[model samples]
Structure formats: C-alpha cells, structure tokens
Target: MSDRYELFLTCPKGLEGLLAEEATGLGLEETREHTSAIRGFAELETAYRLCLWSRLANRVLLVLKRFPMSNADDLYQGVLEVDWAEHLEPTGSLAVEFSGNGSGIDNTHFGALKVKDAIVDKLRTATGDRPSIDKMNPDLRIHLRLDRGEAILSLDLSGHSLHQRGYRLQQGAAPLKENLAAAILIRAGWPRIAAAGGALADPMCGVGTFLVEAAMIAADIAPNLKRERWGFSAWLGHVPALWKKLHAEALARAEAGLAKPPLWIRGYEADPRLIQPGRNNIERAGLSNWIKVYQGEVATFEPRPDQNQTGLVVCNPPYGERLGDEASLLYLYQNLGERLRQACMNWEAAVFTGAPDLGKRMGIRSHKQYAFWNGALPCKLLLIKVQPEQFVTGERRTPEQREREREQAALGQSEPEVDNKKVESNQAPAQIEQARLSEGGQMFANRLQKNLKLLGKWARREGVNCYRVYDADMPEYALAIDLYHDWVHVQEYAPPRSIDPEKAQARLFDALAAIPQALNVDKAKVIIKRRERQSGTKQYERQATQGRFTEVSEGGVKLLVNLTDYLDTGLFLDHRPLRLRIQREAAGKRFLNLYCYTATATVHAAKGGARSTTSVDLSKTYLDWARRNLSLNGFSDKNRLEQGDVMTWLAADREEYDLIFIDPPTFSNSKRMEGVFDVQRDHVELLDLAMARLAAGGVLYFSNNFRKFQLDEGLAARYVVEEISATTLDPDFARNSKIHRAWRLTAR
Candidate 1:
C-alpha cells in the first residue's frame, strides 16, 4: 500500500559489509548494517529484484511494524494492533516464526504461539473465520524478532532460504551452501576473471556448488531464476503485474547471456559417489553446456583450457574436526598445492578451509585473506596468485627477481644467485630438494631415523603403542620426541640463558623441519610445546583450548590424551611400567591412588580387576578427566573419585586399602589446600597420613620426579622401604634412569 517499505537482508556472519555494498547497488536506500543482517528501504519493484538477484542473502524480509514490548502480553497486543486482514485471507494458511528471547518469552515456540493466537483471534472476530497453520507452504509467512526489548515484526519475502538455490537437492558430505559459494567467488574476483574470457576450475568440488554459482555469475543469470513458488506468491497484497514484468526481464537477460559463447568452467571430484550428483546439479541449474564435472583426484587434477587461458581455481577442501582426521588431510592440502603448482600456473587460486594452519602448508603465500563463518566454525578464504614468486622456496624470492630469472633463462644466459639446484620441472617448488634441510637438520633427522629403527621393533615386540622415541640424545638439539600411536609430541627443553637465542632458534627450526620427513608422519600430527620449570600449579594450567582428545592403547587399556589443551598430555609416558605393574598386581585388591592426575593408574587398576578403587585429586578438571578415563574402561560405578586436598582427604578417611600409589607434584600451592606443599618439606607427614590408611600386608608405591628428592632415612626405621626405581624403568625410559625415583614400602 505504501510507495516504499522497510527491508531486512540477512546473511551469514562476516558478510555484512559485503551485503551492505550489494544492497546499495540494488537501489536500496537509507541502509543500515548490523551483525549478520542489513536493513534498508526499497520500493516493491526493487524488493522483487533483490529477491531475484541477491546471491549473498539468506533471507529477504519486509518489515511491517516495530514496537516496544516488555512481556508476552505486550507482544500479543503489539501483534493484535497490526491489521492482518490486509495481508492474509480468512481461509488461507499461515506460519509464524519467532527468534530471540526476552520479556518473559524465553521460549521461541511459545513466542510464535502467542503471535499466532493474536492473529487468529483478530481474524476470527473480524470475518468469523481464521487461517490454518501451514509451515511448509504458507500463504503468509510472519517473522518476529525480539531485539533488546523491542519487537520487529516482518513478512518473509523469500520462502525457505536463498541458499537453497533449487539446484543442489542431492549433495555430498559437507557441501557449501550456494549463497556462501557465491560470496567466495565474488571475493576471489571471479567476475573480473570471467569478463576476460578466462577459464574456471574446482579440483575438490563436492557437489558443483562453486561451478553452478560461477557459471551464473559469468552468464549474468539470476540465482533464483527457476524458483516456482515464493513467500509473496500467495500473499493477499501480491502485485502480480510488477512481479511478472521483472521476471520476464530476468528471463530475457539470462537467455541472451546463455546465447553468448559459454565460459570454460569445470569441476573435478575424487569421490566417485559425488560425480553423478554433481552432474545432476549442473543439469538442474540449466548450465550443463557451460559447466562439466569429472571424476578426478587432486593428485592428478590438470585443467587444460583453450589457448592456455587461466582463470580462478577454487576449492572447498575437507578440513576434518577430529584430531586423527587432521593428520591425513595434511597430505590432501599438500597434494592440492602440488597440483596447483604443477598444472595450473599463472592462475588465481582461492581455497576455503576451516583449518587455516593446513592452508599454510599449501606452499604458496596468499596475497589476501578473508575471514568467514561456515555455520559456527570460523573459516578462511586464501586468495593466491599461482606464480613462481608466490611459491615458498627455501630462500624467499621476490616477484621482480623471479621474473628476471625467467627472462634470463629464456635468453640462455646464466642466472644470479645459483645454488647448484636440480629442478624437476613437474615438481612443486617446495619439493625441489635443494633446500629441503640444512646440515644440522639432516644430522638430526638421521639420529631420529636411527632411534626409530631401534625403537620400532622393541615397541612391536612389547605391544606398546605409546613410547618415547628420542630424549635429548644429541646435545645440540635438546628436544624430547615421543610417539603416541601415530601422533608425535615434541617438548623443547628451555635453552640456558648463556646460549645465543638466535642460534638456539635456528637449531630448533632444523629439528622441527627434520621430524616429519624422518618419521614418515604428516606435519599436522606433530604437536610442539616448550618445557620449562613450572611453579605452583602452573603445569596444570591449560596452554590451548582446542580440547581435541586422541585415544591411545597401553598395556591392554584404552586411554585418552589431550594433545593441545595442556602443557602435559593426560597420560605420563614415564609411568608406563608402574601402571602396568599396578594392573598386573591389582586383582582382588582394593586400590588407592592419591594425587591422581587424570586417574590414569586407577583406570589401569580397574582394568586389572581391582575389587574397588578410590582416587583423590585437588583439581576438579583433572577429576573430571579421571571420570572419563574410568568410564571409558567401563568401571565408573565401582570407582570413587574424591575432589579435595589429598592431605585433607587422607586425614578424614577411615577406610583401608590393600594397595596404594602416591605420585605427588614436586610443589603445589593450590588454593584448595590449607598450605603450600613441597615434596622435600612435606614427604614425611604426607607418607604418615597415607600409611595410616594402608591395611596389614598392603603395599605402597611412592614415586616423584623431583631430581633432588631424597627418601627420608627415618622412614626405613618406621617401615620396610626398598628402592624400586631401577625395576620400574621400561625399555623406552631405560636411557633416562633418573626420570623418577621410586620406592616400595610395607609395614615393619
């Protein structure tokens, strides 16, 4: 009824700025931007055109009214004030969608019901009839958004979501929505490339989303050209003449564009299952002549266009969510980089990935980066120009210099700064092998290989999946490398203050460069941490928030290890022999573990058929981790986890145990404790409290990593104490005998 109406354009996060610019170009006036949404005013004709052409919007809504509300009654009254008769027929069907929560309408379902009731009541009184609810194909679709304390009611102009462009009914796992793909293409400057008659290719296209969107952009075809139904199609105030005029104009433009010479757009997918679905999507989009999808692997993907025309090479590579899945995907990203380097030279490349670190492994530097959100996961789009200068060779080269070198080679002249290199024309620049590793790196790699050769057999013969492969074996490279299943965890011992920081850094780089190549592990599987002397509870604090836990097997028990979150992984590798000893001797015995970090030993005891077990720790985080460890072994109900100061818990306990373990921290000043605990100053009193709970004939195993820890001589007078540190050493830890000091004690 009005000459202009308020419009709300909603899109995915991080695309608000782009949407605002696009809206302005679409003739939207008085524009305002918000998070994930843009608001503006537009005439009816402009609204129709926007719905037809907006490739970045998820939904286009026309606002009816904005009101203030403090409660559900206010919300109902606000809805009742609007004249529903003008928007919906009495016999028609409607759907009410409500978002946000405030003013006592905390539940979205209840909010929608209240709005629906207000509409129904008004319509029933006005015409003695009411509309029925139809969620899928509603004649009038209402949207109510509660922001702060205000209610904004609008009508949905675009039914369903704009991302569902009607062509991708069948798709592969984790397909990108059409609208998001279009946004990525625009960011990668695909339109500019297409204008120059360049070709387009997607090596890892899932379901041809990028291909379809790219073709549409290049051909100037409206994204929603084939949609038969719209939210406004059945509205009471529908303007059929204006809509028909716009629709006809769009159809003519699309037909004219299609008549032009088609662009060379292609997609290659490795999954055979996705090949037909991708082809079907292209066919449904009516761009089969402009786009073709072939079953191909990333390692062998080579797009040959007419006359060596190079366009944009875009892909949405799979970046897995799990810890184990990430390792294998490193090779996928590497292979993709290799293909781009070897096959698609002088092309513009755009890679959208949730894992930015893996994107860095592509061996090319992105000229520009754009951040976007794929649902809740943060993602990045890397724009790279596939030229020789962009390749990250050992020594970084400038574009001007590389171009000069190319010119010199063409003239059959000697080049500057030669490194006696053997270049494989087909290999990626990173794989050139000339600068693969430095002299120090090569020696370190040789040592790692030697260690693995010796340790691999011992690990298999002993059925060990977790073991220390290297521990400061070379004085120059002081890093402890341990293998947890297929993952590598490296800890760098802090260099002394007298050492030059730059030289130390160079050596560290050499060691890191050598690790993956020598061990045959992907670079993504390696987790590095700096090891320094920790004070108080510093060692227990989290170093990262990834919360990614990996599973490893040790002595027939499954254990969980957090490779990223904490300074130390949950399981202590040096304690392998002690845990196995507990498992071997825990049958029919009541076991107690004090100062239990993650309750790893308790899990071992439970697996060994302990009658009952009790574990005490001060940190709730570690106790929770311990519960998971116990539950993972199907021993949750039989085990007891006590969270408090071990000293306090032991003083309050009256139960006795047939076996006990005490592996206290070297120093802990947790706020949960009555006072600070120093292993040297408090060992006597701590052992006395633990011994009181030991039953007759019960055995106690005490161990600590405090290098200067000396067993109190008076304890030998009170009980029988035998130093068992040598016996607890496993083959992997045999080289480091002073790793921990252990003693077995029993009643005198």
Candidate 2:
C-alpha cells in the first residue's frame, strides 16, 4: 500500500467551504477545514487527481516535516535532519519561499539563508557538491511557513498560484483573480440557475473575467485544465504515470462537457477596445461557442429574450474609492438598479462591489447579502430577485404618461423618435404659430425652430455634425443651444437678479421644454450648462460621472463628444469654421495645436494629410481623450499629444511647423503653468512666441473668445497681420459676431 501524506490546499480568503467541498468530491480523505485553507491526508494518487480536477485549489502542498525551534541555529539543526540527497540532486537548482517569523528569526531572508546553508553543508560533506540557489524560475520550489514557535515545511506541488489559467492575456485596470471570480459565481447561485437551463448576462463586463468564469461554470469545464506544468511534475517523488492517467480523465470529461447544448450567455462592455480581449480569452478557454461579448453600455443594455424567459444579471461595477469620489459613481449604481427594476422582471440580479454604501445606492432591496473579500477590500454581493412590484421609480404611469406626452406636445416638447420619422422644423410654419403654448414658451420654441432651419442647410452642405444653432439669440431666453449630431447642448447665460428671478426661471423652463421637441431629440440627450464668467478653472470642472459620449463629425473628421462629466463638451462647436480652414490649408504642412482641448482640430489637420501634428494641453485627462481621438481616425505614430504648459513648450521647442493654431483661454491661473495667462494682457507675447516657431512662408492663426479684445498695435505692425475674423464665422454664428476673433500673422 502506498504511504499517505498530509496535503494542504490553499485558496483565497472567504472561500474555505467551497475549496473543502471540492477536495472531498475528488476523494480526498480526512479533510479538515480552516479559514482560507484546508488540510487533509491522502495517497499520492489522490493528490495527483486533485491537481488535475480540483478547480478551486490554488496550491496542493505536501507537508515535509514539522519541528519546534527557538532560533535560527535550532531551525538549521532541525532542517539538516531531512535527507538532502532524497529530493534534489546536488547540482540541481532550488528556491525557497519563506513566510512568517519564528522565535528570534524575524527576517524571512535571513531564515531562508540559514536553511540553505544547512542543506548545502550536509550535501557537500557527503557528495562534495551542493545544490545551487535560484531565486527566480527555479527547477524545484520549497516553501516554509513559521508559527509561534513551530514551522511546517512543504513542497508547493502547484508551481504558481492556480489563479493564472494561462488564458487571460489582457488585463484591465483592476481585474479579479480567476479563482475569486469563480467563487463569486458559486456564491451568486449561478450553478443552480445554469442547472435549471437559465442564461446569464453581464452588462458592465471589463475584459470579461466574470463572463469567462461564468462560462466555465455553466459548461462544467475544469478551470486549470489548460495549465501545462505543476511543481509536482518535476519533483523527485512525482508519480508520472498516475498523473498522466488522471490528466486523460480530465480531458475526457472536458470533451464531454463541450458536447452539451450551447449555453445562452452574453457580455456587454462600453469600451470597444476591451471586446477583442474578451473574445481572445473565450477562444482560449474553448468556450467561444457559448459566450458572446458586445461593445455596449449598461444604460442601453437590453438583454435578449425579453418575454417570459428568466435568467441572471451579474456584474462587478467599480466602487467609488478606486475610480473616483463615491458621489461621482452614485448615479452609476442608481442607473444599474433602474435598469434592473424597469426591465428584468422575474430575473435575479447580483451586484458585487467593494463599497457597501454604493450597494445601497442600487435602489433595489437586496434579499440576501453575502460578505466576500476582493483581494484585501471587504466587499458585498447583493442578491436581488427582480420583480415588477419592486420598482420605486419616478416615471409616469400609463395614463399619466400619455397625458404628459400630450402636454409636452402642446408645449412643443420633443417626443420619442418615431420609426424612421423625425419632427423637423420645416414641417409647417403656420401650424407652429397656431399651437397653444405659454406666450414665452411659444416664442422660445419658435426662435429655436427658426435657427435650426437657417443652419440645417449649411450644416449638411459643410458635412458638419456639430454647430451653434442659437447663440443668445433671444433676450428673454439668453441661452446658447448647440446641436451635436443628435444631442442638444444648452448653455444658459446667467442673467442679473435685477430681472425677476421667477420670470427668468419660467423662461428658462420654457426653452428647455421646447428644445427636444423643436429639434427632434430625446429629453435625456440634452445636456444643460450654466455659462458664467469664472475666476478659476470651474469652466473645465467635471459636472457629472456618466461619461457618456457620442460620435460627431466636423470638417469631415469624426470626433467624440462627451455630453456629460464636464462643463464643456470635448469639442468647441463655434470653432467649426476655424477647424475646416486648418484642414483646407494643412496638406503637406506640419501642424501645432496649443491649448488643444481634446485635439479635435489636430485630428482634422492629421486627416488633412499633414506630415506631422503635435497637440499640447495642460490636462492629462484631455490628453488621453486626444489620444483616443487620434486613434479613432486611424492616425499613425507620427502624431503626438503633448501634456505641458503651452508657453513653456513654445519657449523650449526648437522644431518649426508650417501651420499653427493658438486658441488660448480668456484667463487661466492654472497651477501647472508658471504664471497666470490673460489673453488681453499677454496676446502680443503669446503671438510673438508662436511666430518664432513658424517655418518660412508659414502663417499662424491666433484666436480667442475674449469679447472685448484689441490687437497689440506695435506687434501687429511688426508682422503682416490679416484680420480674417469675418470669414471665420459661418451663417449660424453671424448673430453673435463678437463671439470670437481670429487673425492670420506672417513674417514680412
């Protein structure tokens, strides 16, 4: 009979029961449970089978010996008793992973050195040779764990932690360990649902850790079957024939599992770049046929099979601490709950988050909450059974919804888009004048429709998707409304309180209510911003955490516009004409963009066949957005997005560009800049600095939005300056000609 050896199985903390059950199922005998660890005694063959079939086991350790020691010398003496020649050859390479501190042995490195000295001395005396120490990628790995006054030395049968399945090639910011992901699935009751022939969906899937883990569970596939090597594979005591036999059994079971009917599983991720990585992982797992990953957002995610069918929706959305402030992410949790409560009747929902308070923001009453650990953070898994009766929303009911729709129509508020239909302003002129609306509301709606009519033709002809539709056109409704493709952005110019506050608010509400209907847009697609003179960077401060974006074209270049998360969308719609001018003159020229928010103008230059383009901005957030814009346009590495103070960069730059665009802020005392910048006070210095970098026969387009700005007469005469501010304004912005000023300067 083969001698039995004590085996220790270790896994992530909080998963002790699941690992213990797995060991028992694999025929392990005398299994004893501990927190985050399990101990059992079994024969070598049983151990081999456990290595091949146990999915939750992180490492299968064979306990070599246990001894009580008082200090380093006693540790060395006790370790020397083990036969050194029995395990590794004198010339073989070995590494020791020591953990914890013993009595009088406080440092792990010193303890490892002492153990090595003892083994080398015993082997050298007998064979005149000693094993070489290899700290990294060693042939044999030894482990020693020290308690109060005792130590247990063991062989780590699993070379590396089993969390690495050798399948995940791409990892996003914060990824869950594979074993921990599997444990979450088990804790969420996915196995029971899958056994009953239900499907699964993950809306906020990041690189698909949860989806891949869920697929493995639903398909009944072993997790580590793809692993090629284990520590025991090279050990002197390994039984090769027995391991190979169990490996073949695992393969047979996997093959049988693959033959079962397809499991209905789907994963949705908002970022398009991450979908490919998820596909690669699924393919590597041999479960591509069962899982489908889509590039989408949870806000618009409508899982398939809307009627009668029931399934589970599980996702690991970000907690407030890791990504940003907790308040910023509260809307995300609330939106997730609203999605589930509104659509997922009879379906079960599980939300796993590190911040328990964020879980409360989910809005649904969780029937059960399971405490788990994601790495070291205390997390909660909220389980909710979605039902129609559980929704506590502010949406109007059926009759009230219709009444509201009719009232909105009477007030000229936009309705949901009809199938292949739009509510254009050119529909009828006389009918709008005849509609019943509040006097101020009717006039506000009429002005909006008129501007859309005037700009629509020019916008279509110029291939512009974003333009200023109304720039403070009506005094009563002093607001600038811009149309970015299908979404509307409304910026209200704060009026003086001398104007009746109630009257101004009423007029503002009338305009807001009219925008969606008059422009054929959804109310949710409108982003409202209050424009006021700022003494600081509050103009660029973030407003919301939705981070929602849409694609809009300007001057034949596609750009991404974020409607939420900031006071200003990435693109400046009034600069549409200026961007087009740059594209017209950018061929074969080098381009520079200073104060380049999102670099939309730089993208136009690059698309216009500029030899090279450099975009400078002070914000890393905007720089990252600029990089994404360049990548979206398929620009090569020749384009660079630089983050720095524009003045400093201009002073340090020795390279010359054929064309440059400088659109500085009116006033910015940015902490990143060495000094404050005011366009009126520093225009000449900024202009001269830019002209110094202009190549021969080059012209610099200097522009700013400062309303009351005057040219520096001396500097203007120094260079041949041509004021082309008239041509820079399209018909839409003609009403507000003083909105911006542009000048073309060239060396005489």
Candidate 3:
C-alpha cells in the first residue's frame, strides 16, 4: 500500500465545512469539502492522527483503488484484482458497507454480496483460507461507493462512526451524536473561548455529549482516546509499531492535560432520569473530576460562582415536533433566554433547535445563524452575543414617572442610560441610527400599527388567526402583509417605473420593524417575498430551502405551510372564502382538486366528510406538502395526491367526481407540462376536460387569478355558469375583488 492516499472523511450534512477545517488542522493535505464529506490526502501517520483527534468526522476512509465498471460482474472482477492479503488475513473476519444509488447495480445488498463473493473466491483460490463474514465488528471493514459506473474502494479505518466516542455508557431519548455536538461547539467558537480561559455550560445536556466534547477540546485530549477498539487493530496494513508510537504520544498529551486544571464544564438536566446517565458518560470518559452534571430545570439553572462571570453557554434544546403542541417548550425557551440574559452578560451562546418559532420565543436577537441538519430534520444553530441591555427587565414606575418619560420623549430630551452609559447624545451612534429612518419608513410603521388594531379584534371574533392584515392599504407602501399564527409574511408587488426603488426598500424595512412591536412577536419570524411576473417555471422556483414549515389553522382544519420558501406560502389567504364554501358543499361527495398547490381546499373538503378526495399537481414539492397536510390532520389514509401535470392526469383519470375544483395559473408553460397553458387562451379546453370528470348534475368550481381574464362566451352559453366572485371575497380582501375570480358551473 502507498504511504500517501486520498482520505475520505465523512460527516453529517451541513457539517462538511467544519470537518474539512478539522482535517486540515490535523496535518492533512489538499483538504476539500463535498456534499457531506471531506476529501484530502494524508500519510499513514496523519490518517491515524485523524482517527485519534477528529471531533467532527464520522469515519476515516483510506482509498485503496478507483476504477471504471459497467455492471455487477465488472465490480466483482475489479474487487478480485485487488490483493486482499495486503490488507487482511484470509482467515480473518470482514464486513462490507456499500452506498450510492446509480449505476446498473442499485441494490446495495446485492452489490455487497457480489464484492464479498469476489474477495472470498480470490482468497480461497490463493491461500486456501477465505475470511468469514462478521456482521458486527470485523478485522477488516470495506466500503464501496458506486456512482455512474465509477467505483472507489476504500478500507474503513474506523470500525463504526466516530461519533460513538465510547464514553456514552447510557443515553436518554433522542440523544445527539457526539460529533454533531462537537460541531455545534466549534461553530459557536468554543475552542477559542476555552483557550482564552473561559468556561462552558450545557443547560440541557442529556447524555453529556456536549460536556465531554467541550472538555476534550479544552484539555487537548484526543477525542477517541477512550475507545476500546479500532478497525485497524488486526489489519495487515496497520503498522503496529508506528501506531504504538502515535498512541504513546497521544497518551502523554492526555496525561499532561489531565494534570492541569481543565476548563470548568458543568451541565444540568431537568429530568433526574438523564442526570445519572449524563454523569455515567462523563465518568466513563475519565472526566468525572473535570466535568460535572447535576439535575436542575432551565428555570433554575445558574453557573457556579467560582467560575468566570461569563463564558460560552451552548445547548441542544428539544425542538418539539411540528405536529405536537409545544406550549410548555415555549416557556422553557423563554426561561433559558432569561437565564442567559440575567447571569451570563457578555457571554456567547449557541442554541441548536429544529423549531425556530420556539427559538424566537426566547426573545433574544442572534448575531448570526448557521444551517444544520439533525438527520433529516433541518435545524439552525443561532450564535448570539448575550448582552444584558437587549432584554426587558420590567422595571416598574409610577404613572407620574411614566408621564415624565413620555413628555421628555416628546420634548426631545436625552434618553436613559444603557449599561450605565449615556446612549442618547447626538454624538452617540445609537442616537444617529434612531434619527436616520426615512419618512416613508415611519409611514409604513404607522400603517402596520393601524391595520393591526383594526383587524386584531375582528380576527379574534371570527377565529381567524391567519389572515391578510394589510394589502397596499396605502399605495406608497404597495405591499401585502399576512399573519400565520405568530409569524408575519410580507409580499412586495412589483413597483411601477415611476417609483424610486430605494424608497420602496426603506418602506419595507419600516414594515419589518413595525410588525414585531404591533404583533408582539420577534422580528426574526418575518419572511419577505417579492411579487413579480413569472414565466415558464418561475413560480415553481424555490426562494429559500430551510425545510421550515409551520402549522396554521383555518376553519377548524390544520394545514402545513412553509412561509419562508417558494413563491406562495402553500395556502392562499385569498382563497379562504372559496375553501369554506367547498367545505360546506362537499359532505358525502367525491371531490377532485386540480392545480392543487398544496391541496388546502382538498383538505378542507376531506375534513368536511367528503367521501374521498384526489388532488393533482405537477410539483412534487407541493405534493409532499399536501401529503404532510393530510397526515397532520388525521386524513392521511382518506385522501390521494398525485404528482403530474393536471392536464395529463385529468385525461388519464376516468373516475367521476361529485364535485371538482379547477384553479389554474394565469399563464404557464412549465417544463413539466406537455405544452403551454394560458387560462385565457386554454380555459375552454381545460374546462371541457374537467367537465368530463364530473358526475351527472355535479358542480365544478372553476377559478384562476388572471386579473384581466375574459371567459370564453361560447362555453358559458353551453353550461349554466353562476359568477361567485362577489361572494368569494373575504373581508380582508374586500377592496381587491380581483384577487381571484370564481364561478360555479354545471352542465345544462
């Protein structure tokens, strides 16, 4: 085997950058990050160093060979050519891991079997002793990656994922992987903080992963020092003498680190069940004296007085699932924010959470947010500078004192002190900023407050938590605002040529500012979108991909909507009236929904006791959202959602429906479709196709959002069409009657 070879260091998604940095720091050459793994070149010694020291890597794979092949037989032949005796004894045990989907051989099981057969047959022919397959830990672990007929064969230097640091003797429910917790710490700047003699804390440390990783970094202890076994132990390629020297050096460093006073590491778990397990893990890692874990709730968490006044407070807070009620979790988050503000002023913080809304409930502003994935769940690691001045202290004052502050504000008096420093002098930067907002921004803020007051009560009376609170109420703003629970969504209409673009932007910032104050929510929860003419597949283009979705209720039905992604927020508020009408009219009827963006209407119909519902849309993204909506509301087994062009699906579908809803886009020539579609130009043909799916005397709700659309008069004469535009307008969209036009049509 060559001394220098490509090392494939795999990590979790969104952690490749951190892993690459770790590999480079460990003396690897030419390190680069791809998708969820890092690639680099390292000698045998450096590769062993990574196995001992890397805190963010999942596995260290040393490539043996790379070749081209076209089929499974070719793979077998390629494997047989490699001298297996060089890496492992023919009498030893082996295990194989095969990944990658494409190529003629897509089955990983079959691929592994073929590779295994080749290895055994080659060894049996040469040495008369073939290795036995070990399903668990093996003397040699082989990894094969196949992509587009190209293969990379590598030896797994680490028997299992490096995240299993062997320190975790017991675990609680859903414990975080050790390497991921390490990534969160490194990204939060814990290494630098610890080096500077600062402390670290995890208020919600479940299994002591974060505490153990933090202690390792601060003490310069190798991450894998506690491992009892390694993949290279019994392999022929492993230079036992060289490995022994490296292990000795690592042991000396760890011994020297232990003699020094380690950075203060403390963790608190609210549940007694987790505290013992966390302590057991810390003890097993030989960190019982350095890192301590205790039972305590976040509501009462506090750092030891002997430690520094501030340090890095990092945590992996429970991100309650989207479908469950998380009322108590919100309070827990609030308490965490309070604890950080009151006790850890000047400290840095990193909160890893899947639910951002719950994070916002903390009422703290973050300096920066990094995206991460906890398995398939997209999460955010919010880096915040915990300054005490940003929180609300609720200082009480007499009415007279309040009047004085208000009058002083009116009279342009100097402001109160911040952190005991004068913050209102004209020379101060904060004062300069407070005076810099444009007039248009102030007007937009005032308008948002006005609209919120006007609609808040009406919304409460009508059980409308999600509605359009503002829709270009003043032309200068020219924006539509929506409220989905506690979140604010703003959509800016394309401005006319006569308007100045800079002024429009200032007004948008003004709106963003006013929303949090008026709605009593955090400004970080706001999502903004620009409305413009879309052609071809422009509407289907993703604006953002956080995989963030929230549940919103409408007329007693819960539907999932992604406010920060796509051109639309899944559910169209303008179609509220139409959806309600369909719900009332859909009892005991079979329903069909075409161009169903997220099947919100179909959900409504199914909730209203429709016999069965089928929704058709071309975008798989929307279809997945529709299915999630169905599952969220206990209707997963009751409805069917198909991903295909509405026209093609309609032609192939022969089942008759008692009710049908068609709401196509104004104009579309989507790449997924067979031909161009224009509601104005193709309305006749589209309606004819949809009409064929309706049962005798069945009703069809035909609609579209083309403002200037004119119905084909010939079809109207053939069918009984009643214009429902007047009744379909909700109170919030009353002034914009052209938001969407609809008509109930039945065959004559």
TM-score of 1: 0.65
- CA lDDT, every model vs. true structure: 0.87, 0.78, 0.81
Write down the TM-score of every candidate. 0.65, 0.58, 0.56
lDDT of 2 by residue, 1-748 (tens): 2389999998888788888888998878899887778999998888877776666778888888889999888889888888767777777777887878958998999988888887777677454667888776566778887878998888888888878888898977788888888887887899998888888889988888888888887777778888887887667787788888878887888788778997788998888888898899888888889889998877777766646557899998876442123223544665587577545766898888886655654545788888888878988888888753333322224655556545654444433122223325444422221232346756778888888897898888877778889877778788888888788877878888799866775576557646766787755567777777876567787877777778877766778888767778999877878898899899999999999989988999998889999999999989998988888889857898888988888899899999999998888888788888888998888888889999999979988888889988998677999988999988878998888999999998
Residue-by-residue lDDT tens digits, candidate 3, 1-748: 6779899999999999888888898899999888889899989999999999999899999998898988888899999999987888778899999998666787999999988998888778454778999979899899999867798999999888899888886998888898999999999999899888888888998988999999988888898987867888888888888888988899999999888877788998888888888888898889998898888888677775853456889998887553112334554676687677546766888999987655665646788899999999999999988753343323334566546545654444534333333445445322222222335545666777777887888889989889998898888777788999988887878788888866554455555544555566654576777778777668777876678989999999999888766778888998998999899999999999999988999999998899999999998978988888888889977598988888888888899999999999887777688988878988888899999889998999998888889988898788999989988987888868889889999988
Note the residue pairs that clash in candidate 1. Answer: none
Segments of candidate 3 deviating more than 4 angstroms = 125-128, 306-308, 322-324, 388-748
Q: What is the lDDT of residue 557 in candidate 2?
A: 72
Q: Stretches of candidate 2 above 4 Å error?
A: 28-35, 125-128, 300-308, 320-328, 393-748
Report the candidate with higher lDDT, 1 versus 2: 1
User: CA lDDT of 296 in candidate 2?
Assistant: 85
Judging by lDDT, tell me the better candidate of 1 and 3. Answer: 1
Alpha carbon deviation, residue 482, candidate 1 (Å): 8.1
What is the number of backbone collisions in each predicted candidate, taken in the order shown?
0, 1, 0
